[model samples]
Target: DQQVKQNSPSLSVQEGRISILNCDYTNSMFDYFLWYKKYPAEGPTFLISISSIKDKNEDGRFTVFLNKSAKHLSLHIVPSQPGDSAVYFCAASARSGSYQLTFGKGTKLSVIP
Candidate 1:
Protein backbone atom coordinates (compact mmCIF):
# COMPACT_ATOMS: atom_id res chain seq x y z
CA ASP A 1 0.00 0.00 0.00
CA GLN A 2 1.25 3.44 -0.87
CA GLN A 3 0.87 5.47 2.27
CA VAL A 4 1.39 8.57 0.21
CA LYS A 5 0.58 9.10 -3.45
CA GLN A 6 1.20 11.68 -6.12
CA ASN A 7 -0.92 10.55 -9.03
CA SER A 8 0.63 12.73 -11.67
CA PRO A 9 4.19 11.88 -12.56
CA SER A 10 4.74 15.10 -14.41
CA LEU A 11 3.23 18.46 -15.33
CA SER A 12 4.08 21.20 -17.77
CA VAL A 13 3.21 24.87 -17.54
CA GLN A 14 4.28 28.13 -19.03
CA GLU A 15 6.41 30.58 -17.18
CA GLY A 16 4.38 33.06 -15.10
CA ARG A 17 1.52 30.57 -14.87
CA ILE A 18 0.22 28.74 -11.87
CA SER A 19 1.43 25.16 -11.21
CA ILE A 20 -0.59 22.93 -8.99
CA LEU A 21 0.49 19.52 -7.63
CA ASN A 22 -1.71 17.11 -5.77
CA CYS A 23 -1.03 14.50 -3.08
CA ASP A 24 -2.94 12.03 -0.98
CA TYR A 25 -2.27 9.98 2.13
CA THR A 26 -3.87 6.96 3.73
CA ASN A 27 -2.54 7.24 7.27
CA SER A 28 -4.69 9.12 9.70
CA MET A 29 -1.95 9.38 12.28
CA PHE A 30 0.04 11.80 10.20
CA ASP A 31 0.18 15.15 11.95
CA TYR A 32 2.88 17.00 10.06
CA PHE A 33 3.05 17.66 6.34
CA LEU A 34 5.88 18.98 4.18
CA TRP A 35 6.64 19.85 0.57
CA TYR A 36 10.11 19.46 -0.89
CA LYS A 37 11.59 20.70 -4.15
CA LYS A 38 14.50 18.96 -5.80
CA TYR A 39 16.76 19.53 -8.73
CA PRO A 40 18.30 16.75 -10.75
CA ALA A 41 20.38 14.31 -8.69
CA GLU A 42 19.98 16.45 -5.59
CA GLY A 43 18.24 15.94 -2.32
CA PRO A 44 14.90 17.56 -1.69
CA THR A 45 14.78 20.91 0.08
CA PHE A 46 12.05 21.83 2.44
CA LEU A 47 9.66 24.23 0.77
CA ILE A 48 6.80 24.60 3.20
CA SER A 49 5.12 22.67 5.95
CA ILE A 50 1.83 22.62 7.83
CA SER A 51 0.70 20.87 10.93
CA SER A 52 -2.52 18.94 11.13
CA ILE A 53 -3.95 21.64 13.33
CA LYS A 54 -3.76 24.12 10.47
CA ASP A 55 -5.39 24.02 7.06
CA LYS A 56 -3.13 26.28 5.05
CA ASN A 57 0.46 27.47 4.96
CA GLU A 58 2.25 29.72 2.55
CA ASP A 59 5.74 30.95 1.82
CA GLY A 60 6.72 33.30 -0.91
CA ARG A 61 5.58 31.76 -4.23
CA PHE A 62 4.59 28.49 -2.60
CA THR A 63 1.44 27.55 -0.73
CA VAL A 64 0.31 24.27 0.80
CA PHE A 65 -3.25 23.44 1.69
CA LEU A 66 -4.24 20.45 3.75
CA ASN A 67 -7.63 18.82 4.04
CA LYS A 68 -7.54 16.51 7.00
CA SER A 69 -10.99 15.09 6.43
CA ALA A 70 -10.07 13.81 3.00
CA LYS A 71 -6.44 12.96 3.84
CA HIS A 72 -5.32 15.14 0.98
CA LEU A 73 -2.92 18.02 0.40
CA SER A 74 -1.77 20.17 -2.49
CA LEU A 75 1.01 22.53 -3.44
CA HIS A 76 0.54 25.62 -5.54
CA ILE A 77 3.25 27.67 -7.18
CA VAL A 78 2.34 31.09 -8.47
CA PRO A 79 3.95 32.50 -11.59
CA SER A 80 6.11 29.50 -12.19
CA GLN A 81 9.47 30.07 -13.74
CA PRO A 82 11.91 27.89 -15.64
CA GLY A 83 13.88 27.72 -12.42
CA ASP A 84 10.81 26.16 -10.87
CA SER A 85 11.09 23.20 -13.22
CA ALA A 86 11.98 20.47 -10.77
CA VAL A 87 10.63 17.53 -8.88
CA TYR A 88 8.29 18.26 -6.01
CA PHE A 89 7.69 15.72 -3.31
CA CYS A 90 4.95 15.70 -0.74
CA ALA A 91 5.83 14.19 2.62
CA ALA A 92 4.12 13.49 5.90
CA SER A 93 5.12 12.37 9.35
CA ALA A 94 3.40 11.36 12.50
CA ARG A 95 3.93 13.18 15.79
CA SER A 96 5.67 10.22 17.30
CA GLY A 97 9.28 9.09 16.98
CA SER A 98 12.02 11.12 15.36
CA TYR A 99 9.64 12.75 12.89
CA GLN A 100 10.77 10.59 9.99
CA LEU A 101 8.95 11.68 6.85
CA THR A 102 7.35 9.50 4.19
CA PHE A 103 7.49 10.82 0.64
CA GLY A 104 5.53 10.53 -2.55
CA LYS A 105 7.23 9.49 -5.81
CA GLY A 106 7.22 13.17 -6.80
CA THR A 107 5.77 15.30 -9.55
CA LYS A 108 8.14 16.75 -12.12
CA LEU A 109 7.00 20.24 -13.11
CA SER A 110 8.34 21.58 -16.36
CA VAL A 111 8.05 25.30 -16.95
CA ILE A 112 8.24 26.47 -20.51
CA PRO A 113 10.09 29.58 -21.45
Candidate 2:
Protein backbone atom coordinates (compact mmCIF):
# COMPACT_ATOMS: atom_id res chain seq x y z
CA ASP A 1 0.00 0.00 0.00
CA GLN A 2 1.15 3.52 -0.69
CA GLN A 3 1.83 5.25 2.58
CA VAL A 4 2.57 8.81 3.69
CA LYS A 5 4.61 9.17 6.84
CA GLN A 6 5.26 12.12 9.12
CA ASN A 7 8.28 11.57 11.29
CA SER A 8 7.43 14.31 13.75
CA PRO A 9 4.23 13.97 15.73
CA SER A 10 4.28 17.61 16.80
CA LEU A 11 6.25 20.80 16.64
CA SER A 12 6.58 23.98 18.72
CA VAL A 13 7.53 27.37 17.38
CA GLN A 14 7.59 30.90 18.71
CA GLU A 15 5.54 33.49 16.92
CA GLY A 16 7.28 35.19 13.99
CA ARG A 17 9.59 32.20 13.61
CA ILE A 18 9.77 29.70 10.83
CA SER A 19 8.02 26.34 11.09
CA ILE A 20 9.14 23.39 9.06
CA LEU A 21 7.02 20.26 8.72
CA ASN A 22 8.35 17.16 7.06
CA CYS A 23 6.75 14.24 5.26
CA ASP A 24 7.78 11.22 3.22
CA TYR A 25 5.91 8.93 0.89
CA THR A 26 6.61 5.36 -0.27
CA ASN A 27 4.98 5.34 -3.71
CA SER A 28 6.73 6.78 -6.72
CA MET A 29 3.57 6.52 -8.81
CA PHE A 30 1.94 9.26 -6.77
CA ASP A 31 1.97 12.50 -8.67
CA TYR A 32 0.15 14.97 -6.47
CA PHE A 33 0.98 16.08 -2.95
CA LEU A 34 -1.04 18.27 -0.62
CA TRP A 35 -1.13 19.66 2.89
CA TYR A 36 -4.19 20.32 5.00
CA LYS A 37 -4.56 22.22 8.25
CA LYS A 38 -7.26 21.41 10.77
CA TYR A 39 -8.40 23.18 13.88
CA PRO A 40 -10.09 21.71 16.92
CA ALA A 41 -13.57 20.31 16.17
CA GLU A 42 -13.44 21.60 12.61
CA GLY A 43 -12.88 20.05 9.20
CA PRO A 44 -9.51 20.33 7.57
CA THR A 45 -8.80 23.21 5.20
CA PHE A 46 -6.51 22.94 2.19
CA LEU A 47 -3.21 24.63 2.82
CA ILE A 48 -1.06 24.00 -0.23
CA SER A 49 -0.05 21.50 -2.90
CA ILE A 50 2.64 20.60 -5.40
CA SER A 51 2.75 18.45 -8.49
CA SER A 52 5.38 15.77 -9.00
CA ILE A 53 6.72 17.67 -11.99
CA LYS A 54 7.32 20.75 -9.87
CA ASP A 55 9.82 20.87 -7.03
CA LYS A 56 8.06 23.62 -5.14
CA ASN A 57 4.83 25.56 -4.83
CA GLU A 58 4.19 28.53 -2.62
CA ASP A 59 1.28 30.70 -1.51
CA GLY A 60 1.93 33.56 0.83
CA ARG A 61 3.33 32.05 4.03
CA PHE A 62 2.67 28.45 3.06
CA THR A 63 4.97 26.57 0.74
CA VAL A 64 5.08 22.92 -0.28
CA PHE A 65 8.17 21.31 -1.69
CA LEU A 66 8.46 17.98 -3.49
CA ASN A 67 11.55 15.84 -4.00
CA LYS A 68 10.46 13.06 -6.31
CA SER A 69 13.84 11.36 -6.25
CA ALA A 70 13.65 10.88 -2.50
CA LYS A 71 9.87 10.62 -2.44
CA HIS A 72 10.02 13.27 0.21
CA LEU A 73 8.29 16.61 0.69
CA SER A 74 8.04 19.35 3.26
CA LEU A 75 5.97 22.40 4.14
CA HIS A 76 7.47 25.66 5.29
CA ILE A 77 5.64 28.38 7.12
CA VAL A 78 7.45 31.64 7.53
CA PRO A 79 6.87 33.92 10.51
CA SER A 80 4.53 31.43 12.03
CA GLN A 81 1.62 32.85 13.98
CA PRO A 82 -0.28 31.64 17.01
CA GLY A 83 -3.39 31.19 14.87
CA ASP A 84 -1.32 28.88 12.69
CA SER A 85 -1.37 26.34 15.50
CA ALA A 86 -3.18 23.31 14.15
CA VAL A 87 -2.90 19.70 13.08
CA TYR A 88 -1.30 19.38 9.67
CA PHE A 89 -1.74 16.38 7.41
CA CYS A 90 0.25 15.44 4.34
CA ALA A 91 -1.63 13.66 1.58
CA ALA A 92 -0.93 12.18 -1.83
CA SER A 93 -2.83 10.74 -4.77
CA ALA A 94 -1.88 8.90 -7.93
CA ARG A 95 -5.10 9.77 -9.65
CA SER A 96 -5.12 13.13 -11.37
CA GLY A 97 -8.76 13.28 -12.34
CA SER A 98 -10.22 12.66 -8.91
CA TYR A 99 -8.18 13.20 -5.78
CA GLN A 100 -8.44 10.46 -3.19
CA LEU A 101 -5.94 11.45 -0.54
CA THR A 102 -3.82 8.93 1.32
CA PHE A 103 -2.87 10.97 4.37
CA GLY A 104 -0.04 10.96 6.85
CA LYS A 105 -0.79 10.50 10.53
CA GLY A 106 -0.55 14.28 11.18
CA THR A 107 1.73 16.76 12.91
CA LYS A 108 0.36 19.16 15.44
CA LEU A 109 2.03 22.56 15.46
CA SER A 110 1.85 24.85 18.46
CA VAL A 111 2.86 28.39 17.56
CA ILE A 112 3.46 30.29 20.78
CA PRO A 113 3.74 33.99 21.25
Candidate 3:
Protein backbone atom coordinates (compact mmCIF):
# COMPACT_ATOMS: atom_id res chain seq x y z
CA ASP A 1 0.00 0.00 0.00
CA GLN A 2 2.98 2.30 -0.23
CA GLN A 3 2.07 5.20 -2.42
CA VAL A 4 5.62 6.23 -3.23
CA LYS A 5 8.23 3.63 -4.15
CA GLN A 6 11.90 3.63 -4.96
CA ASN A 7 12.48 0.24 -6.54
CA SER A 8 16.27 0.39 -6.18
CA PRO A 9 17.38 0.32 -2.59
CA SER A 10 20.89 1.44 -3.48
CA LEU A 11 22.81 2.97 -6.33
CA SER A 12 26.54 3.28 -6.97
CA VAL A 13 28.16 5.78 -9.28
CA GLN A 14 31.70 6.68 -10.12
CA GLU A 15 32.95 10.12 -9.26
CA GLY A 16 32.54 12.75 -11.98
CA ARG A 17 29.80 10.57 -13.48
CA ILE A 18 26.08 11.04 -13.54
CA SER A 19 23.86 9.57 -10.85
CA ILE A 20 20.25 8.99 -11.68
CA LEU A 21 17.75 8.16 -8.92
CA ASN A 22 14.33 6.87 -9.84
CA CYS A 23 11.01 6.92 -8.01
CA ASP A 24 7.46 5.82 -8.75
CA TYR A 25 4.11 6.65 -7.28
CA THR A 26 0.78 4.84 -7.27
CA ASN A 27 -1.39 7.75 -6.17
CA SER A 28 -2.41 10.12 -8.91
CA MET A 29 -3.59 12.70 -6.45
CA PHE A 30 -0.03 13.76 -5.77
CA ASP A 31 0.47 17.35 -6.80
CA TYR A 32 4.08 17.77 -5.79
CA PHE A 33 7.29 15.72 -5.75
CA LEU A 34 10.17 16.33 -3.36
CA TRP A 35 13.61 14.77 -2.97
CA TYR A 36 15.50 14.77 0.29
CA LYS A 37 19.11 13.86 1.03
CA LYS A 38 20.19 12.50 4.40
CA TYR A 39 23.72 12.27 5.70
CA PRO A 40 25.04 10.10 8.51
CA ALA A 41 23.42 11.05 11.83
CA GLU A 42 21.92 14.16 10.24
CA GLY A 43 18.38 15.12 9.48
CA PRO A 44 17.22 14.79 5.91
CA THR A 45 17.74 17.99 3.99
CA PHE A 46 15.67 19.18 1.10
CA LEU A 47 17.52 18.76 -2.15
CA ILE A 48 15.21 19.59 -5.00
CA SER A 49 11.56 19.43 -5.85
CA ILE A 50 9.22 19.66 -8.80
CA SER A 51 5.59 20.62 -9.16
CA SER A 52 3.21 18.39 -11.02
CA ILE A 53 2.62 21.11 -13.55
CA LYS A 54 6.21 21.05 -14.74
CA ASP A 55 8.01 18.24 -16.50
CA LYS A 56 11.50 19.19 -15.35
CA ASN A 57 13.30 21.37 -12.84
CA GLU A 58 17.00 22.00 -12.58
CA ASP A 59 19.26 23.61 -10.00
CA GLY A 60 22.96 23.70 -10.78
CA ARG A 61 24.08 20.05 -11.05
CA PHE A 62 20.80 18.64 -9.78
CA THR A 63 17.85 18.05 -12.02
CA VAL A 64 14.43 16.55 -11.32
CA PHE A 65 12.01 15.29 -13.89
CA LEU A 66 8.37 14.42 -13.46
CA ASN A 67 6.05 12.52 -15.74
CA LYS A 68 2.65 13.00 -14.27
CA SER A 69 0.95 10.84 -16.85
CA ALA A 70 3.21 7.93 -15.96
CA LYS A 71 3.37 8.65 -12.24
CA HIS A 72 7.16 8.52 -12.43
CA LEU A 73 9.93 10.88 -11.36
CA SER A 74 13.70 10.93 -11.39
CA LEU A 75 16.60 12.90 -9.93
CA HIS A 76 19.84 13.36 -11.84
CA ILE A 77 23.13 14.52 -10.38
CA VAL A 78 25.91 15.27 -12.76
CA PRO A 79 29.60 14.99 -11.88
CA SER A 80 28.78 13.01 -8.81
CA GLN A 81 31.12 13.64 -5.92
CA PRO A 82 31.90 11.75 -2.76
CA GLY A 83 30.11 14.32 -0.67
CA ASP A 84 26.98 13.63 -2.66
CA SER A 85 26.72 10.16 -1.21
CA ALA A 86 23.64 9.89 0.96
CA VAL A 87 20.23 8.34 1.29
CA TYR A 88 17.75 10.04 -0.98
CA PHE A 89 14.06 9.95 -0.18
CA CYS A 90 11.28 10.67 -2.57
CA ALA A 91 8.17 12.25 -1.14
CA ALA A 92 4.83 13.39 -2.41
CA SER A 93 1.96 15.50 -1.15
CA ALA A 94 -1.60 15.97 -2.24
CA ARG A 95 -3.28 19.29 -2.99
CA SER A 96 -4.76 19.29 0.48
CA GLY A 97 -2.16 21.96 1.51
CA SER A 98 -1.34 19.91 4.57
CA TYR A 99 2.30 19.28 5.46
CA GLN A 100 1.71 15.54 5.53
CA LEU A 101 3.75 13.80 2.87
CA THR A 102 4.04 10.21 1.66
CA PHE A 103 7.64 9.13 1.51
CA GLY A 104 9.44 6.29 -0.21
CA LYS A 105 11.82 3.86 1.41
CA GLY A 106 14.72 5.91 0.08
CA THR A 107 17.63 4.99 -2.19
CA LYS A 108 21.12 5.00 -0.79
CA LEU A 109 23.54 6.59 -3.24
CA SER A 110 27.24 5.87 -3.07
CA VAL A 111 29.51 8.04 -5.12
CA ILE A 112 32.88 6.37 -5.45
CA PRO A 113 35.91 8.35 -6.27
- Over 1-113, each residue of candidate 1 has an lDDT whose tens digit, in order, gives 89999999999999999999999999998999999999998888989999999999989999999999999999999989999999999999988889889999999999999
Scored by Cα lDDT, where does model 1 land?
0.95
lDDT of 3 at 71: 94
- Winner by TM-score: 3
lDDT of 2 by residue, 1-113 (tens): 53999989999999999999999999777899999999999999998989898999999999888888899999999989999999999999986556678999999999999
Ranking by TM-score: 3, 1, 2
In angstroms, give how far residue 39 of model 2 lies from its true place: 0.3
TM-score of each: 0.96, 0.94, 0.97
> Where does candidate 1 stray beyond 4 Å?
none
In angstroms, the error of model 2 at 108 is 0.2
Give the lowest summed-lDDT range of ten residues in model 1. Answer: 91-100
